[model samples]
Target: MSFTLERAQAAEPKILANGMKSFDHFRKLAGIPKLDEFFVDAGELEQLLPGLPLSGDSALDKLSMLADNDYRTYAVGLTRWNTSGGLERKREVEYPPASNKIGYFNGLALVEIWVIDPPVVKASCGHTVVNPLHLALSYSDDKRIFDERVSLELGNMLEELGYEFENRWS
Candidate 1:
């Protein structure tokens, strides 16, 4: 189905609900005994709820808006960095640069959805680099186990939404 603002708005509630459920599944699969300790200050199940509405004309905008709305500190700057594997890396990036010989679309937002306990799945907004908008999900850990578990959880959530999603790992 075509992605429209109205459609997005309609899907928001279910999407958020599933997103949180996906997180819980991730925690269980990851063998995280305590959700409170695993998910920063928020207690188990509390952190996932009442996700803020992300505002923007584009899907990336909405995602970023939702991320920002959920975490105020991260939104002050257009980009933020988090430590992963002992190195600090920018959490967001522009999709296409002018130097590329192949035509690639821009205005896409590549966001890393951060959770205290890392999930296995990597989420992306578009099918390819040429796609205009994207929201890619990555975790702090680089373990294959995490990636696999997260991918499964994410796949299940997307499936519940009836959204076409690709599992890059398989």
Candidate 2:
């Protein structure tokens, strides 16, 4: 698929075009690099979620396998802080009970893809804090969507921390 998201649509349609227009627009504004890969075929997806019974041995088994794979593939970053003499060093923590809930909204197919390393706050010194870094990858066409989503999320986070707009933007 070309996935081009150029000309704006006359009106929001019931179905979201898989074209890359909206994604490109978001990427340009976020200053993110183009994605390297975006499409995944059924076989590839199967590799990640194996144990599918041919046609009725046990559909539940296949579902369990898929769910397990989903959880393993998507992870969100977690962090914890420690107090020290005048200064603090941040530590990257593991995901808590309910982490990694990144979802894709395609109008018809809305699925929550597992998050691999959700960002987490590591430490704070009442002035500055550290957050775990998470790098997301995708195909060039969808880079903009990922960029916009991350930018908006990060912006809100920094704002909540009371960080100055200039510093946060920088």
Candidate 3:
């Protein structure tokens, strides 16, 4: 579920030299597959397909791609993936010094999640931070329930991780 320091360091050069999409040749490296981050189970895929921002035609096309492959382990033997979490926290120890990233590698973590109505998973890489809440959308009209459930589930998960929040919305 995590990236290996060695394999990640090896792939880092390619992403650094060219953009993140560079080195397609080395895409099938010796590590975890990247598809896990994007694709869900076929059953969950059907339920969440509408949540994705794709046209009707493109969505169908994605199903076509899925039909032609074995997901979850499509290319388990290849394709390396990493969280890319702390790599940006301090690529080099200069300017303002931060130790959160280092502590993240250890078992120490302090989550300060923002309170928002719609559920959004904020992903950060380098200088890019994207909150793709749109992916949580569905065709259902009773969206408030989903929002409440998200808040509850997220709160439960955070609490299970031994995090307690102050001044958080109830």
Candidate 4:
């Protein structure tokens, strides 16, 4: 489907609202030291996540596989950190888990399409980290990339996977 700027303007609030955790939270969980493929310290990362991927080229290989094939990057949700929102408090006490799979960097695919061994939950959801590397801040208001590429895809994929989307905007 063709995504338009108006649609993006309308959807921005909802996209930002979907279950955002901190970069530190998912970073520890995913065992990914950094977002871009080039910056990962393999040796240290391996020490951290013993069993999972992230050895040598395996992590990038897996990233390409997940992104190109099954919307794998979507699994590790990348979101804009709402500075005003602050840290996310633990809310599972009230609602059922937002995503069916609540994973902590195990490398197992969290998508419902794949029934992982023992039925593992969601692997990772990308979050907004206010950092120099976050290019979203650079986007001109009229040309916000959130409407076009990764964010839209990730948001839609989450909805499809039964993620209970929350509109913190309202």
**TM-score of predicted model 4?**
0.23
Candidate 2 residue-wise lDDT, 20-61, digit = tens = 123223323333211221222334334443321111101111
Model 4 clash tally, residue pairs: 8
Candidates' lDDT values, in order?
0.26, 0.24, 0.25, 0.25
- The best candidate by TM-score is 4
* CA deviation > 4 Å runs, candidate 4: 1-38, 52-147, 161-170
How well does model 1 score by local distance difference test?
0.26
lDDT of 3 by residue, 61-85 (tens): 2322212112221111111112212
lDDT of 3: 0.25
Clashing pairs in 1: 54-66, 120-146, 120-147, 120-150, 121-150, 121-151, 123-137, 125-135
Please give, for residues 105-170, the per-residue lDDT of candidate 4 as tens digits.
Answer: 233321111111111122233322112111121222222232333333333433443332242111
Model 4 worst lDDT run, 10 consecutive residues = 111-120
Go through the candidates in order and give the clash count of each. Answer: 8, 16, 0, 8
Using TM-score as the measure, name the better of candidate 1 and candidate 2.
Answer: 1
TM-score of 2: 0.21
RMSD, model 4, all Cα superposed? 18.3
Most lDDT-accurate candidate: 1
What range of 10 consecutive residues in model 2 has the weakest lDDT sum? 80-89
